[model samples]
Target: MTEQLPDTISRLYADPGEYVDSDHPAVEAFARAAVPSDASARDKARRLYTAVRDGIRYNPYVSMRSPESYRASSVLAAGNGYCVGKAALYAAACRVHGIPARVGFADVRNHLTTEKLRQSMGSDLFTWHGFTEVFVDGAWRKATPTFNDTLCAKLGVKPLDFDGHADALLHPFDGEGRAYMQYVNDHGSYHDVPAKFLMREMAREYANMQGEDLAGRDMEREATEQ
Candidate 1:
């Protein structure tokens, strides 16, 4: 049985934020279409998780300076985004179904990144790696819909899955048994995208990202080359 949410955490189901615009028409429609109206909370969460995970492609080559880059609706319309945008979209979709959800951030060392991406970021340590946290079955469960199936196939990594009951974090090793991702630091969870703080920290950490035009670059192509 699903447990009741406390007063403090109930606000997570309140109106959407600037980034996680769950009230947007597209997000609402997408969420509704992903699951049946009679579906239970866990079923809805599982369906929405997979819909966002595979429906939208994961593309790391995007301009971080643009606000639209982080907006959930924009990410859905564009059909691609990095971890942050994808997480925002997943949270937004969950909210549309009256599910309490939030975005979580962590610093992870990606040991299996492509060379061009490694050079672009200047390090394999990715800060603000985003994931979705949904309150289901009486607990806040983490769900990472970052790496899509196609990209994971190209990179020889298994796609992350969400069971709506357990945390779906990144794997510690790839298919070849090589080290893949390691969580170094956690930034906790937020009801909305902390855009200003996130951009400020990102600017301070990644000097090359400022004014960098990452257009036309394809992460899938790079993964295939590796």
Candidate 2:
């Protein structure tokens, strides 16, 4: 039986925010094409999770200076984005199908990162790492679709998958038992991408990240080289 969603929860699927523009034509079409319309909520969420996860190449080198970088439709059109943008895309896609979803943020110490990226940020601690909180089966399940399967394979870590029932967070250890990602703190969830606030926090945290156009840099190639 489908559980009754409260007004607050229902509102999550309503208006299309500046970033999470679910009502956009392209986003709606993408969501509809990802799964059959008659699929269960869990099935829909699961399909959407994988669609955004692998469909969008995870590229951390992209510039965060523009507000358009964080917008879901723009991210989808670009074919690549960082964690936050991918999360926003997933949330927007889910909302297109009436699945209540929100973007969640956290600070993680990533052990398996490119040396160039680490130097660029001056630290391995990634702030505002984004994931999606999907409401399924009367509970909010966390899904981290940031690292695609191909990248995880190259990094020697298991690909994060969503079962639509459990939280799909990053693994703390790699296949060889080496330390991987350590979640330091969580910044809670939001209905839409807090673009300005995230950019401000990112600028404050990563001194070298602001206003830099890092296009054409292949993060996957860097990972393979490392």
Candidate 3:
């Protein structure tokens, strides 16, 4: 299929049907959260980000790799989730304000250390990890704020700000660290590395991340710790 804007945006903004504007109190509060009258696109994106990063902490009480029945209100009430829930909450909030945002993912190395596993476990690092992308200026930029201290400390990599226009700091590993190439709907064709579709594939493929947390998963944990 040829790349078309409306069709592409339609798929990109497809509702998860899990959360909506009035389903929960938290969602309502977030909807009411101030969107400054003078805000620009970046300001709007940042506001949505602050809501999740500061409002919620990262905890996997819900199905870690799968989304629960979290409406924006439920997430606000609970104030926590792994990645998907928080990202869903953020995306929902941004959408309500008429901002164009969608979920995205990457395999960040050294993401966390689990209690049952002290060593590098591959699949645990890539499960349903979600981030948001907002339309700005003439293009879309990425943002990741759901990852918090616990997960960052466990993985030993610095979590970054969701500016909606900066490169991801949670690199798999390099001098300054590098990013996992996005991998969704890949047909072994010429790829652009950051297409939004990769988020879907990333959520599905690495859902069972377990064991050695392969070099592909988080080589930094292995090289730095050992």
- What residue pairs clash in candidate 1, if any at all? none
Best by TM-score: 1
Model 3, C-alpha of 89: deviation from truth (Å): 0.9
lDDT of 3 by residue, 57-76 (tens): 76543433232423455566
lDDT of 2 by residue, 81-104 (tens): 999999999999999988888899
Of the candidates numbered 1 and 2, which has the greater TM-score value? 1
Candidate 1 versus truth, CA RMSD in Å, comes to 1.6
lDDT of each: 0.90, 0.89, 0.51
How high is the lDDT of residue 58 in model 1? 93
Model 2: lowest-lDDT 10 consecutive positions? 207-216
* Stretches > 4 Å off in candidate 1: 1-3
- Which is superior by lDDT, 1 or 2? 1
Tell me the deviation in Å of residue 201 in model 3: 11
